[model samples]
Target: MHDSYTEFILPFGSSPNILEEYTNASGGIRTGKLMEHLDSLAGSIAYKHMLGPGVETVGNTKEMGFYIVTAAVERLDMLGPLNPARDLRLSGQVIYTGRSSMEVVVKMETMPGEFDEKEETILLGRFSMVCRDAHTHSARKVHPLAISSPEEQMLYSKGEDMKRKRQTRAQQSLSKVPPNSAEAEALHTYYLKYGQEEELDDISSSSQLVSMGDTRVEKCMLMFPQDRNVHQKIFGGYLMRLAYELGFANGAMFCKSPVRFVALDEISFKLPVPIGSILRLTSHVLHSNASSPQLIHVGVTANVVDVKTGEEQTTNEFRFTWASIDESSQRKVVPETYKEAMLWLEGRRALEMGDEIRGLRTQK
Candidate 1:
């Protein structure tokens, strides 16, 4: 169904693959697994688009195979929670394309029953995937997308707009030098306090500094064949799920209560994790809203470790925002060491960027 653009629907029923028992107060289908599905579905749509219509029997060669890796998740809004009984319906399409990358928009909804006419949106996300040669492992040019209908044209334009906005926001957040803006100045003064006082080595310190050790939440899992993608690498979405869950737990621990996920800012996949690799996910509370005590930001880092050598390489970094489940849950977070201070700055940068974009969206 590749002509220039292609779309498809993937339906999945509740299974152990996507469901996990909650060890906390929050209970729902595993979101990480759902994200993995979304990534796989998007990759499928991109592959279908590459295999133009009427083109059958494409050889699985480095130059011909349409292997794609998720480069980044621009944004994912969890409009609602996933219900286990409901069948997951992922409607995805190749919305836009560049020289070697394609933009895939996937809308995840759930049908209450087999014959249910109405579906509820669980979450919707935009993924950036780059095509790569199967053997050479380099970026490969993708088939250009064609826009025929006005609706298609509108979506294509919207994709371009989002791309530009992501670029601008990224540039603003990744400045090498500290920004001279008032917000950055404020954060500068805040971080300077860390250097002024003796670093606390324990979690029981009376200072505003929250022990980095206290905020750490680590989860390790064995990557199974079930989570492998077409290329046999661990799915980016699965890594996302792991990061999300760990980040959720970190937020909860920091707030001393259950935390509700509000937004996933940006998730960047640096390298693909191979199947059978030991996946170690580490999450920590990097920053907390200074004004809104209930808002917390956590950073999740995924590392693939060599089981034999015990060496590790970073794979992906996920940033998530969560709010205290209870309105009465209020607390502030501070870094206890220079290392943790740097992490706090990173989180603050992302949080400020998100707030800036959100403000602009509200104005629009």
Candidate 2:
């Protein structure tokens, strides 16, 4: 009776008081966006566990938690168009371990309730999570004893098996895309437009993405808890936070400095993440262009899945733009190392779309 992930201790079989929990949201049972749920789940977990046994060691290590997704898979059964109800459960298990980074096995499912039917799996996936202590709120290190128990060893082994599969999938997704992928083209155009227009009113933001001179820098850390709503499973907020961190990371990567998050675009909680499920988070450099208040856009996608059931519990995608103020030259600059080709391609598509839209507008 042991939960297994990989490399590190998942800290299972231990009791530290359920940090959070979530249930089905119906008839206004839940309110607020998905990011809030992520916040609550992560907050509850950090408050209780990461801070345990060695409060001094775990103190203020938020940035160390920035998680990058490397792989994902979903079963996605065809419900067709029946009652059309769904359920979700999520799990995070370590699949790969580097010197300082690790990958987690993430999945999602239809948690049974109300209209929830039997034998339905919506999504399955895996992700890469890099643990570092540079950009977050404090010093960082993965808990050595985090999975030191005999029970944890088993979870770690399972995670290793999953790592091989997940790595395979990640490579396939990147290399095997269609030649004329509408999805890829659409993503490029959408991001370009999003980069141009989005403005922030949320003063909470300290900076934004405008440029990328070069190189890749790590940004944003995200955390998920085993308990979600305290009443039910997990909330959509976890999804949003994943997106936010992705944006934050991308923005910082572009500027090579800390970036503040101002706004999120078109976030929909297709599914809910559950407590105890591992979360896979990703932040990628999408596009960075134009000087003088340059703009850099980052994309965020999250997948949560069940560890025991091998089912998917959460899936969502979002776009984020981070901005910054140039200090030395008094002008914004974006470092464009890993993002050159992608950014150029995105710009080309956006330019095409703009031309088409303008052509249509003139016809009218």
Candidate 3:
């Protein structure tokens, strides 16, 4: 872990030009751009772990024999707000390794004021990277991580648990199987409460339900080579930024107010987007909470369009959570079809996980 440790500093406070590049229209830091930096940093850390700390550059992939690619982003949680006036440090290390994959943990923190002052972490994320043989494009074995301390051991254990949980979740995915009895019952109850036209006609009721379909926002563009990664394919970070911006827009439209980004719940890279391809992104408000500090769950799907056939193949799926700034925002999303209902349930699950993770962070 120590060998793979890496850090980079963004002098947003001291360098005006640097800050200008990252600043958004609202004067806050662009989380999407920061995500690109994180992805690059993770890749560097993985290479450092594989090629040793002394290696300055990945000289040649063909000569090096093996290269790494991001398989998935497990989760990225916002622990604190980003302060544009302060310098930020991004750091991480490889905590766990499998036969050909590694779990890299990264954190974004504000630079300390004094020498003795501790940095305040603003974000935490985990990235899954897999090593591939350059020639065969097949999985290549990576060095096993050495566990030297109890803390490191605990982190490794957590990484192992994450992998298992991912497998379990994949097996239980709605695309593969029908919802269990409990989920079915919950959907039935929701339908009875909000799906009926008579129930919707009751203006006296406190519930303000909006159709899930009504909250959709989409963007379509041609993928350019400039956004390509080392593999000559559309960069994962670029795709992430696109999806995030779309989700943010969709959330804002649904809430009718500016929303604060809470967390990037999950991102799955199903396939790579090729250069010069038609990329289409569609986002919808999957779930909404009417409680104080109302939260909205946004889901984005990225697809590559076949120009001749007019067919689209899904390449990625992203889930994000945003919080409405206005306390009075109380519109809840209601699914009208069985497919939408399943998506609603998935969004609710993601929000529940976010809540649990945030609670744990607060306790810590």
Candidate 4:
């Protein structure tokens, strides 16, 4: 991937022929597919180029599952009037690393695919991500960054500046909650605090998974053979499709009516599943409430692992949430069992956390 600047014209478009498909009509080349294209590049670029070396050793193995920490970035550069037709380029460099987290410097631009001084910067952003141990599916410490280049040094300094600014803002914006603040504690607990060993749940256990009860859970196993790459890896979007499909069925079954996807509450991609691997998707009702328009929170987790390894290290877990709209005048005989009660507790906890986060964000 170090030489990817030339190799990766790279799935920039939705089709095999990005150049022909993303013709002059696609967002006038300034935005649109270009924006989406840039957005998709962050993870791949970070994993491939931002990391120093030995990324493969850290990525996946038999004992440790893959869960790479990810960072967020925003778009930069809007050459609105100047050279509007230019093909943009984005750049990222590994900046800094700590025991558990790493930061990368990312930039976007309206230039050719090549990386040169002439490749003027479009937008500049950075990310802080963490990689976790596979068996426990928990965040773990990592080696400090391995870069010693002048270019790396420069990027590291810039990333540190960004990090400081972000920390200051986060600190000022989110006020500390009092220990007795019920609303605050409920809303921020899962997010702000780590789960205890006893409290933490396993992904493979059906006990932790919600139940459809007597209702059926729908699952679709899709292998996009045509979408296969030389490395035999499946596209993230491909897996995402199967995931949402499974989630849609769970929601539809529970609602017993037409359902619509409202939001992606939380999503985490722990490891990369190969193209042919089976994606065992499970979705169950976390909980639901009677709002003016009812909101049902469904939890979907996809476990896709390499059957060849047959070890804890080969599996990748993805967790996501989908909210559905329940407009059915008719309702099914929903079961009120032990699992439902636990799910209700989890949902309640999530709601409180969300409320607190929003409160903190707004208080800014």
Per-residue lDDT tens digits for candidate 2, residues 56-166, read 333333333432221122111111121123333333344335544354443334444454346443323333333434455233444332456766677667656656654
Between candidates 1 and 2, the lDDT winner? 1
Off by over 4 Å in 3: 114-118, 199-207
* Best-to-worst ranking by lDDT: 3, 1, 4, 2
Q: Assess every candidate by TM-score.
A: 0.81, 0.33, 0.94, 0.45
Measured by TM-score, the strongest candidate is 3
Candidate 2: worst-modelled 10 consecutive residues by lDDT: 74-83
RMSD of each: 4.2, 17.9, 2.3, 12.2
Q: Where is model 2 more than 4 Å wrong at Cα?
A: 1-227, 305-314, 327-364
Answer with 2 or 4, whichever has the higher TM-score: 4
Lowest-sum lDDT 10-residue window in model 3 = 199-208
Identify the superior model by TM-score, candidate 2 or candidate 3.
3
C-alpha local distance difference test of each model: 0.72, 0.41, 0.89, 0.47
The positional error of residue 357 in candidate 3, measured at the CA in angstroms, is 1.1
